[model samples]
Target: MSDPTDAADLTIEQLAAEVGMTVRNIRAHQSRGLLDPPEVRGRTGYYGRAHVDRLRLIRDMQADGLNLAAIQKLVGSGGEEFVGFRRALATPFETGGAQIVAGAEVRRLLGVEDIDEATITRAGRLGLFRPLGEDRYEVTSPRLLTAAAEVGAIGLRPEVGLDVLEKLDRHAQAIAKIFVELFLAEIWKPFQRAGMPPEDWPRVRDALERLRPLAGEALLGMFEPAMTVAVEKAAERVVERIARDAEKGR
Candidate 1:
């Protein structure tokens, strides 16, 4: 119904049909304490917008792999707070957005006439790009493509950048797992074991939201010093080899 006033006029059968749910399912949800009982008038129980909203929320939770028992617990604890947690979890962790590029532009950037099938396939596997079936592609990270292009400008093949990216992705996944596991173990488990109190939901949701940027900042902070040390050692080895070659020639 367009108005909340009209929504209260809906019978249980009307509510089920409006929400695309079976009446039996609605009754089952009621029996499981997932749905609130409707207002009774004379011989009829009239459902309202709140019931419709709850059913929709339950449907969405089920779609996200939460069972009825979990949904009931979450709803009984406080549906709104759990919803906020879900919304926070669904938010993207990555900062940048993707862009679409023509195949010719991509080739020009990579310094290739025609990208080989294997390289394209490898790029797809790395989530670098998705083919749009008409000489176009959706690049997940334009910055990464630009970096590869810069590598090509220095006379290195794009595959070199992709190789480094593949390795980086592997390490990044491991690092991500560490951060997520840390949050679940240290933050979430304690809250969960405490019966997921209503008041703590906001704190838990806040922690998850705050973790998105913290994880990135922490990774970058750690990586900078490690990268500095690695570069220094690599440069030392290169200089040593060059001097040894010069001495041998003398």
Candidate 2:
């Protein structure tokens, strides 16, 4: 058995298996600057946990709808810079800490005693929580779980919260598509056509990091007013119905 602390002991095949990636995909990621080259030891390159972590991060970003270009920019920053950039990108959206709890505990946390299995599956699909093993789950975001719990407390079914999240996921996907198209057209394409000199990589990375916060701010700015308008219209309709009911009662 290879010592876990000895990173030099892992072969390419072992690394691929550990990270759940194909060897070709790992090489592709290395070419795209999303991963570092492995250390060479007597004609064989040895990979370590860092490579595994980078692969996992890339996969997570892809799951979050980021394309390779975006992932490259984020990961190309290197070391502390990349860490800071990733934290900046995540700070706006995820405010609470995560918790790992058993599946039974998840049901308790969600305030659903007899939750349907399909509803739990849908919740996982919508990024509510990830299954840890047979009977455990890692709640990705406590704030989201709290919101679900609150909704359930208000007499709505837990499945209703999952439905709402599914709708929001659809809307988010649409918005992501538009933004990616705009970014590709306005930013990446022009840079590519300009010959994409090696010297320009840092500038591109900087632009991506800067835009991360700006995009978050823009989404919040847009969503707040839209939500306000929606709430106001709904309130007006409810008021009108109440007034009509009062007149009929009189």
Candidate 3:
């Protein structure tokens, strides 16, 4: 099947396969009104890319131990804002300080685990921990150090969080570099050579005043943790050197 995001149509079976769910299961959720199918096309009913995406999202949340009820609640509460919020939340917030615990009450509302200072701090520096107000933060840090630490706690040493943070710092730098260059080169195209008419200038002029920073955040924001692996692979030598240095604590 074509990419669900860009595809014109997807059959029930195709949607099921794309989302790795059985046709019966997909239909069952639809029957339960958990998901909605798109417009019917010809003999085969087709779901839009958004439907496929929502299904995949549900699948991932289910995999992460969210029950259907919780998913529904979470999804429903956001509504028109859901897509934007989900897209934003899809990427882990990056920070380099204990911003989360510094504002622990909010995270408690989201059932996010309380992590140590390193996890909080690193996430803050990465812009992963978003400040709500009065020193409160949303446990949306990109590192997810607490989640990883919880796993290790059940079996191995907790200090592994340090390694994760160190690795994240290196990867975060690469992402920032990519985002900075992309905006500086592409987004600034109109302003590079000349000025605009006073009447028509607001959009372009305001974009410089407004969108430049937001675009920087949005682009870097989408570079999820999984992309870090791509960075590692592309710079395998750098990874090796970083790894060696970590091994020596230098």
Candidate 4:
């Protein structure tokens, strides 16, 4: 089987070559109705450029943990149009009850200042992030920079570390925004006063004090998987787009 010489007119041999299959194997697929016959260009059974594209898609689906039979059902059975819809049906883990993790605690754990406290302190003053306590500062706000600084490679300087944190600050904000909204919505319901005197607000407050942590517990179940899958799917889509671009230039 020859590789695709041009995108517009493809041969069975070319399709097999692009996808690393033999002509006999490709013919078998055609007999099984897994692939439609390409428009005849002459005496040859020509496959459209679309055939190559579909094969590539099936390869990717397999990598995503789908079996060959499932991939056939999806694309061969003309369910390609529903690919995105099927993806949307996936169960994303719910992420909830995320207590505002103090960035300072993360920094302390990552040892962001071990390389250069003086510089780190200076960066902090430059709005790196302040601690929530009387004398403490969190490695908050610019999360990206904090991460870089903490993971500073063996020779990475404090300045470079701060730069990483600055980058994170940008990306993390969008993620945090969604998380914050969900958190407050799921965990912060106000209690209705139940036949209590207007002056006795403390009773309601006390009830809420207990309710807060209890409510927080319920959120962990959702947030844990939600965030993980979102990040993964985002990365996968980015790479997939890049690959598509590369294929176009081929």
Q: List, residue by residue over 35-67, the lDDT tens digit for candidate 3.
A: 886577676687877888778777766765668
TM-score of 4: 0.33
Highest lDDT scorer: 1
Off by over 4 Å in 2: 1-98
Worst 10 residues of 2 by lDDT: 77-86
Query: Which ranking of candidates, highest TM-score first?
Result: 1, 2, 4, 3
User: What lDDT score is found at residue 210 in candidate 4?
Assistant: 47
Better of 1 and 2 by TM-score: 1
Best by TM-score: 1
Q: Which tens-of-lDDT digit does each residue in 65-152 have in candidate 1?
A: 8899889888878677887788789877757788898999989998989988898999888777878888999998777778778978
Of candidates 4 and 2, the better by TM-score: 2
lDDT of candidate 4 at residue 131, scale 0 to 100: 46
lDDT of 4 by residue, 98-192 (tens): 22345455455445544245664656654554445543554444444444545654567556666666675576466556654544454333322
**What lDDT does the true structure give each of the candidates?**
0.87, 0.75, 0.60, 0.56
Better of 1 and 2 by lDDT: 1
Tell me the deviation in Å of residue 128 in model 1: 0.7
Candidate 3 global CA lDDT score? 0.60
